[model samples]
Target: MEKNDFLCPHCRGHLRPNNKIILSARTPDNKVGLILLSPELGEYSVVKHDSFKIKEGEHIDIFCPVCHADLGTYHENKNLAKIIMIDEKGIESDIVFSEIAGQKSTCKIHGDQIEDFGEDASIYTNLWGATPKY
Candidate 1:
C-alpha cells in the first residue's frame, strides 16, 4: 500500500510502514539480527548482514492503525511480525492481518491495537525479497 493509504483509523495519524522491523536474537547469546520477510509473499526471505545497533532503554515508534495513535516503544526482540510468507512453489503471499508477536498498546482514537500490517510494509517486503529480474 502507498503511504497515503496509511492513516490511523482513530486519530487519523499518518503512519509510514517501515520495511525494516528490527530484532535482537534471544538465544545463542545476545546478538542483533534482521529477518527480511516478504510482506507480499508472506514468508521469510533473507537475514541481514549488519547487526542492529540499538541503545539500552530505547523505545521505537509503533503506530496504531485504527486511530493513528503512536504506540510507545518496545524491546527490539519482542517486536516480531510475520509480515510475509512463501509457499512451496516460491510464490510470495502478503498477510494483511498477521499477528504481531509483541504489540503492547491500544489505539488512541479507536481504543484498539493496530492489527493490520499496512500496505507499505507489504510492498516494501515484496520489493526487498523480490528477484533481481522481476
Candidate 2:
C-alpha cells in the first residue's frame, strides 16, 4: 500500500501506513471489531464490537472512503483471537512458514491427500477477476 493512497474520511488528511490492520471477534456476543494503526499519522482507529461475521481461512478487503484506496487485506484466525494478516499479496510478497512446534507433520496448501477427509477442503477460483478489488 502506498503512503498517499489512503485519506481520512473525517479530516481528509493522508492516511499513513502502519503496514498492519487487526480484526477481532469478541466472545459470547461474537461481535467483530477492527483496529487500524497508522505509523505515519502516529494514530490509531479502533472500531469496537461491530456486527461483522467472518470465517477462518477467508480473505478480507479493506478500503478507505476519502481516497478510495485499497487499504489492505486481512485474514481471520482460529478462535476469538485477534485476527492477523498471515499473507500480504501486492505490497509485500514472501513465503510464510508455519510450525506446529514439536508436532511431526507436513501440511501443504495444495498437495497429495493422505486420507479422504471428505468435504473438509475445497478449492475456490475467481474467474474474470471476480476476486476482491483490494
Candidate 3:
C-alpha cells in the first residue's frame, strides 16, 4: 500500500496520521483537537473539538500549531472538510469532502481535478485533471 503523508504548507512539518487516518491538531484556544480522514476512496473527515467556540454542525477552523497555518475547515454537520495540500516539489492542491449525494471527495490543482472519489458515484484513482461533480 502506498503511504500518504500530509504536511504543513508553511513548515513542511509532517501532519502524521494516527492509526491510519486520524490527524491531531491544537485548537486556537490551546486545546487538543482532532480530525479523522477515512481511507475509503470518497472518505470524509470527521472532526472533534471541545474548546473552540463553534456551534454544533458548524465549520471549525483547524490550524497547525507549529506554524500557525490554516490547515482547513471541518464541519461535522455535513461531514465536510476542506484542506490545501502542498506536494514535495512545492506544488499545491485542494482537497475537499462532501457527504451529500453520498460521500464524495476530490483533489484538485488550480481548479483542475487531480483525484476524484465517490461512494455512490464513479470512483477514479490515479487521476489528474477534470473535476468530478457529485
Candidate 4:
C-alpha cells in the first residue's frame, strides 16, 4: 500500500487498490466504465477499457466504485470531483480534481491550507477563497 490512500468521501471506502485509484465513471452519453487513475496526485495518466471512449474537453461524471456515490456533487463546483486522502499517519485531507477530460488540475486541502497542482490548478484557486495570482 502507498503512503497515501484515496477514498470515497461518502462511503469512506478504500479507492486505491493495486496502486491505482479505481473510480466508476459515466460519459455524457450514459456509457459507464471503470477508470483507473494514478494514485499520485497531478499524474494525469489514465487506464480504462478501450470501449469507454472519452473525448478531450468532454465532461465525465465520477463516482465511488464501492458505494456508487457521485463524487462530483461533494464539491461546490460541479466541474470538479472530491475524494478523501488519508496519509500513513492517519491525517485526512480533501483531494479535489477536475472532472473534465484532459483538464489538468488538482488541489489538496487540509484545514485552511490549500496546495494546488498541475498547470490548470490556478483556474479553480479562487473557488476556495484563495487569492488569485496575477
Clashes of each: 17, 0, 0, 0
* Model 1: per-residue Cα lDDT over 35-92, one tens digit each: 3333233233434465554333344333454353433322233332222223345433
Candidate 3 lDDT over 11-118, as tens digits, reads 666554543344444433455565555544455545455453333333445555457665553333333444555545666565554423233544444355455555
Which candidate has the highest lDDT of all? 4
Tens digit of per-residue lDDT, candidate 4, span 47-109? 999999999999999999999999999767899999999998889999999999999999999
Mark the 10 consecutive residues where model 2 has the least summed lDDT: 94-103
Candidate 2 backbone overlaps, count: 0
Predicted structure 3, TM vs. truth: 0.46
Q: 76, model 4: CA deviation in Å? A: 2.8
Per-residue error for 61 in candidate 2, Å, reads 0.9
List residue ranges in candidate 1 displaced over 4 A: 1-26, 50-134
What does candidate 2's lDDT look like per residue over 68-88, in tens digits? Answer: 433332212211111112222
At residue 109, candidate 3 shows an lDDT of: 40
Model 3 misplacement above 4 A: 20-32, 39-41, 45-56, 72-93, 97-106, 114-134
Say which prediction, candidate 1 or candidate 2, comes out ahead on lDDT: 1
Inter-residue clash pairs, candidate 3: none
Error of 2 at 27 (Å): 20
